[model samples]
Target: MNNSLQTMYIEMVEKALDRYVSTQRCNNDHVLEAMRYSVLGGGKRIRALLVLNFNRILGGAANDAMEFAAAIEMMHAYSLIHDDLPCMDDDDLRRGKPSCHVAFGEAVALLAGDALQTLAFETLARNTSLEPAQVLQAVRELAAAAGSRGMVGGQTVDIEGTAQTVEQLTGMCMMKTGALIKCAVRLGCLSVGADEASMAQADIYADAIGLAFQIRDDILDVIGSTEELGKPVGSDAEQQKATFATVLGTERAQSLAEKLTRTALDALKQLNVAEDDPLYEMTVELCSRKK
Candidate 1:
């Protein structure tokens, strides 16, 4: 990520995310604590950035989009918590600390993930700045993206060993990762009631980066160090999960990522985006990410 992204995550997103998970607001102290811990544990926060930046670009205030942005991050955090469960990816390291199931008991972690997911919708609905229709639109899109038709669908496919080819893998990535990324873009646009043309162009940008981002993840899983990534590497290979690297080879996967990034940049250019926009820098950096 770039300096702007870091600053946004630290100065803006962190506070918004924290304000929602206070222990005083829940039933059991343990699940509430776990929810707080998991949500605050942290990551790149790329989804929230997509929401805020797209909103800002379309003449909406960043402050006005805070609830939507923060809600998406909560959704993302819940996904990570569930993904790291023993029955799922089975990882014991997350956000440079013990996995949710390790830091908290499995039952508590499961309930916590469930809680965060519901809380995400509540947070989205709590948005006071946006129109009711606008908020409804975002909520509808988010539910679809997070439900059986989208991210969870992708996870099911991944676990079921259905992605045997490059095309299948790409399709899976679209739902697993691209759905949220695309939804973030949509949420931003909806916040400001952006025109159809801009929304179309934004989708083009989102799709390219979304897949490109996954391609980079595949590359990193092969070559990234555990210390740098804050998680164990080679799990994909060990699990025999097919990836861009496995299907297309590392060199070709790298080439594909670069090509997809170019496509993303071209979409932004078509929209006449400013040259110094953080999105431009972020898109460029995604291809060369070391971790």
Candidate 2:
């Protein structure tokens, strides 16, 4: 059942993402090509899936949440493109393909990231299925999550706090990697008019899983193969980037990831949702994922 659900979810997200890129129009072919390339670059689309799952949990239609999901994905993609720049991580590859800066020039890649970031807001604002108020709220949530107060701020700390202690490093990872994830779930709840209590419950789940997600990522960087991960293995070590493996050691990091997954599952219990719910199972599987 989990396999079926995962396959279905991946298919749905892929179709939505494909449509999103194809529908976009730009004056410059180069800019358009870069944007499409960056977005079409394959990924797990976990953030978008989180949005969809929470939207369902909150009683919103999946279709109603589709635009917002796509928007969030665009924002995520933009971040990755910028993160892989020569001035940033200087990654040459992503998802088994050349990095955006490698596929296109650095200037075009930068423009593509910028375009995708702006397009995220545009997509959210243009979501006709949602009320104006809901759309506006989602936009505001995304702005905070993606902007200086959230992911960007976290990234700044990550770069500056490289030599910091484990606690500081964890805090940076939480902000940089977890903020947008929290926003994804929160926006889904808001879309369905969930009460404060329900939103808070969702927040607990998001917070735990968000941190777990990053911890697993750090683990993957150490142990996962490039073929399985679709990116260079041990890139963090190669770049001397501080990670959970670097500070806490691999065994403890793995244990922490398991603990966080339990925390996320426990938070979901407050929802009174079904045990057999696909979202619940997906959340569990995500933390335990090998790749």
Candidate 3:
């Protein structure tokens, strides 16, 4: 799986993220603490890895993508903070520690999310390595993904619990989870000015993996342990969330995830990356992730 390369990329992303959310940047000490707590809180960093690896694999300097990767991670972290708010999922645990709203007050956590989200765009707009047009394109991609018609739209539907059928939930999952995931690769393609065909392949790959990721998460929530997941398992069922696992039985869901993993790998055929590429490895890893 080229674990060492994966680790290096993850370290690069972590450093970039820390640099963006550093003490010198956040003026308010209290909010800074909350921002750091959530942004720096450990997770798989899969989204950032997707950004860097896709960029590098598509002929962009991985370094050029680092800031953008950090920006995406910031956005992801912000979403997590807001997702755990009292008005949202209202869970207490995140990454095995108290959620942002639990560790910090709800107000601070909310502000922390808001600040982190803005910082993401700032980081993108501030980058000098990429051309102005590329940066602007990246901004548009991120905005569309994070904005009301994308992730926010999916979240609104989920909160409303309006999705009953599998098709409806799958569509919602695409908006909520797939939007950012697809945007990560799209930014990678944009960073390198990859060809239209290449970008199209990457989007197809992202779509398959993104759905597999959420389906796997639904599976894990049912069968995984709190110690492994770093949060309470079975919370989806507890909340009566319409998950792939709930809509389809775990066996069927597992089968579907495997099928999607194959589809993701197949779409990457046109990217011309060898099977040994970290992108391929990570997609496979995600398919069987225990946490």
Candidate 4:
């Protein structure tokens, strides 16, 4: 996206997250605090931006999409919190700060993640602006993406160390990382009643960019700095995890990302979208992003 619109999205997503976190309540405030810390912690908020931008493309109101955008971010934060647990990635850092498990005790961190996951669906269900059918459709989409069929399934494969090839690893990445992303974009269309053709093109674009995103992430893990990445770099290699960079080599991984970017752009073009469409720019920026 152009600098101005990109900045606008960042600001809007951040504000929505802050507002949502502030509204959450519980008798034991500690878990809530941890949830806030995890959800409000710094990151790109790419999923949220995806929802917002796609909603914009479908002529949906930005304000109307904020809740869905924030919901996606909550789900993403939940996944990250669990992903960094001792039994998972075993990372101590996230977004330049202590991971939730490190900052809070593991029990509280675990509860925080659970809460966020549920809250995401709650946010979608409670959105009264959309038709009840639309909200239900969005909820189902998110549930499938976050559940065993998507992110959880991918994580299972990753933890089992079952992937042994570039294609296998890429498939895992699609489920683990790209599923939520695809859901995010699709949610925008569903919420706005975008036609089936629009949704079809969105699927094409989301699928391509989702894989491209993981490839770029693998590339960053190889070449990125700890400071710039806001987390430990080279963790994939340290853990001997199969990744695009490891399977295809760095140069080939980079080329694959570009190729996927081209595919995403082509899909977007087939929709007859404007030349200045934010999705186009965002896809380009995502392929080249360093952190």
> Top model by lDDT, which number?
4
RMSD of each: 1.3, 1.7, 1.2, 1.2
> lDDT tens string, model 1, 134-240?
99998998999999878999999999989989899999999999999889988988989999999999999999999999999999999999899888889999999
> What digit string (tens of lDDT, one per residue) describes model 3 on residues 30-111?
8999999998889888888888888888878988888789999999999999988879888899999999999989989999
TM-score of candidate 1 versus the correct structure, residues matched by position: 0.97
Model 3 stretches with alpha carbons more than 4 Å out: 23-27
Instruction: Report the candidate with higher lDDT, 2 versus 4.
Output: 4
**Clash count list over all predictions:** 0, 0, 0, 2
Position 28, candidate 3: lDDT: 67
lDDT per residue as tens, model 2, 1-291: 246765676677778777877777878788889888878767777888888888887778887888888888999999999999988788888888999999999999999999999989988887888789989999999999998888898988866755467787668877888989998898788778789999889999988999899988998889889888777888788767888877788889889988988888888888876778888888878876777
Off by over 4 Å in 4: none
Please report how far candidate 1 places residue 8 from its true position, in Å. Answer: 3.3
lDDT of 2 at 55: 85
What TM-score against the true fold does each predicted structure earn? 0.97, 0.94, 0.97, 0.97
- Candidate 2 Cα lDDT to native: 0.84
Model 2 stretches with alpha carbons more than 4 Å out = none
Relative to the true structure, candidate 3 reaches a TM of 0.97
lDDT of 4 at 280: 80
Instruction: Give candidate 2's error at residue 117 in angstroms.
Output: 0.5
Per-residue lDDT value at 173 in model 2: 71
